[model samples]
Target chain A: MHISPTPQDFLDQSLLLIQARPKTTRITTTYSTTSPSLRAKKTALWLAKKGKPTPPTTTTISPPTPTTAPTTPQQHTAHLTLKTYDPVSGTTIQFVTREIRDVGRLVGVLGRAARGMGGVKTQPDTVMSDAPVPTPTPTPTPNQAVLHVAEADVPRVGSPAPTAARIGTPGPGGEKQQQQHQQQAGGSGGAQGKGKKKKGKK
Target chain B: MHQQLLSNEEFFQKLGLLFATTTKQELGSVFLTQKRLTPYDQNPEKSDTKPQEDTLADLALAETPGPVLVRATNGASKQNRDTKKIKFSTLIEPDAVDAFYVRYAEVCKSGMTALKKKNRRRKNKKKASKATKTEGASA
Candidate 1:
């Protein structure tokens, strides 16, 4: 059976190193002659920009001179190094390589792995632990509010006027019904009068 | 002395063995370096005499194929100074570099035995919880 090494064992055995450097390629170009016509055109444009009159075309143009300059182009390469040590044989070995792509993702993975093996606590964990636990405050639900009102008004359950007054204010349909009832019993005034009398008696 | 180029399989096997032998007390670190490769023509004067087409072709041919160089070293500690230090460097093909990273990452994440132990503990906990539920229902 192939037994896999533990993370701690792997951490102890190996080290990873990723280094980034800019690779520069230099290319030298030799120009045998600068084009006389092109140079003259450039001179004419410069004179115009400077608000000066253009020179006559009859003026002799200088011959092209040979010039050489080296141009360098730079690109980035990531070098990855892995070092491992053997305890049984007492031998240490190292491996190094350069990679041109996916350097960011590779570094991120390796960082996470190293932190895991080292048992390093991350910032987010410490922040979460230090934060206070939010205590839930009681919020009055619609049903609970109704129940509380009902309980308080239990003593006045025998009086219909007070009960109707309280219920009619909450519901539009109940208020309409109360209004129609008052209109039908024009002599009795309204439930409001009865609610007032009940309050007085209490 | 001539250095022998190790095949990919041989390199991986040696890497695995090295990892297998390392103990927990040792420290592991990773250093990443990125750089650009610039190709320089040695004979600029000679190239000037050649045709423009030939120079262009030469530039194309001179372009170096980017190869990843990997070097591994083991046992450089003060305590292990008496032991022999083994160091090997190899050029890895670009296509195979991804495989190497994946393997290295896997080894770093966790060991197979540790995962198995965790799974066994979880199973035992589940079984115990089930037995308690059955006992409560019976009582």
Candidate 2:
């Protein structure tokens, strides 16, 4: 009769079996497809969402937590392929990058591309300068009435009456003319209420 | 055959690191791929026509946690037989990633809501047509 394998032999075999099994699987995929405008809109929208409070329901959509996975500090190359079609050329172009920073750049470029800025060679400063800046104009609300003040007739420090600023040519003579004209109009218009009583007395 | 040299564990770990750095430092990558496809290719059984690549379905954004990948495709080229490959790599500033993540949840929510609304509209249209058909038959 042949001798059977010992407990140590069984343990050793188990260890070997554990070592033989593959530790990791091949590729996992996550992908989305949308028009350039929609992508840009999403990007812009997401950006705007940063400062605002995120709802609890949104927790469902948050990416899966990586902490659950076993990980170690190591460097590995990932094949990131990005393809876009050139309408002018009638061909599709695929871009690949391993650098994380490069991916960020690609996104920036994609975002720009989404905004209808066709690929043109330009420096960062130049690109920024070229983009149109949206300046907000102060529009008067329906409830609010803007008091118009003429520049030429603005009240002087010593001279005590409030008047519209003189709007014409800037000069001492021009200012004086405006002031005189304003005084005549004021004198005529002031013949009301208290002013009427004072004029009658005079 | 092993196309990528890195071990799966190591590769995943690196990907984890990529996400970590990206999320923490607010820097991420964008990957893009574009391919040509025909209109009949989507449902070959339904259309008994040759794949001429007439319809273009370009631009797909892969939902990877590490980096954003935009895959762009266009209709087939009649004259050009060879596929074009473009590899553009550069370092991106932090702002882009920040914007992406900030709006990520909202965009996903809105997209889902929009899809739901579209389905609802379709259902309503179908129901209304059915009711009108029944009424017409009775009359």
Best by TM-score: 1
> What C-alpha lDDT does candidate 2 achieve relative to the native structure?
0.34
Candidate 2 Cα outliers beyond 4 Å, as residue runs: A1-75, A86-89, A117-202, B1-139
Residue-level lDDT for A105 in candidate 2? 41
Candidate 2 TM-score versus the reference? 0.19
User: Model 1, B15: alpha-carbon shift in Å?
Assistant: 1.7
For A1-202, candidate 2 gives per-residue lDDT tens digits of: 1111332332233222212211110111122223334445566678678865433433543222232122222222233444443332233333443333333444444443322211122236877888989999577565443332343345557764543343434578878888999999888777666777887899
Over A73-162, each residue of candidate 1 has an lDDT whose tens digit, in order, gives 111112333333322223443433332222334434444333322223334877788999999958879999898888876766575567
Candidate 2 CAPRI level: incorrect
Candidate 1, position A151, lDDT: 82
- Put down candidate 1 lDDT per residue, B1-139, tens digits, no spaces: 2333466566556555544333211232222221122256698567557656553553343333344444444535667565445445455454444555566445433311111122434555666667677768888
The digit string of per-residue lDDT tens for model 2 on B1-139 reads 1122243234333343333332222122322231111122466444334323222211111111122222212212458524322122122222344444234323323322111122434555666667677768888
- For model 1 chain A, the run of ten residues with the poorest summed lDDT: A22-31
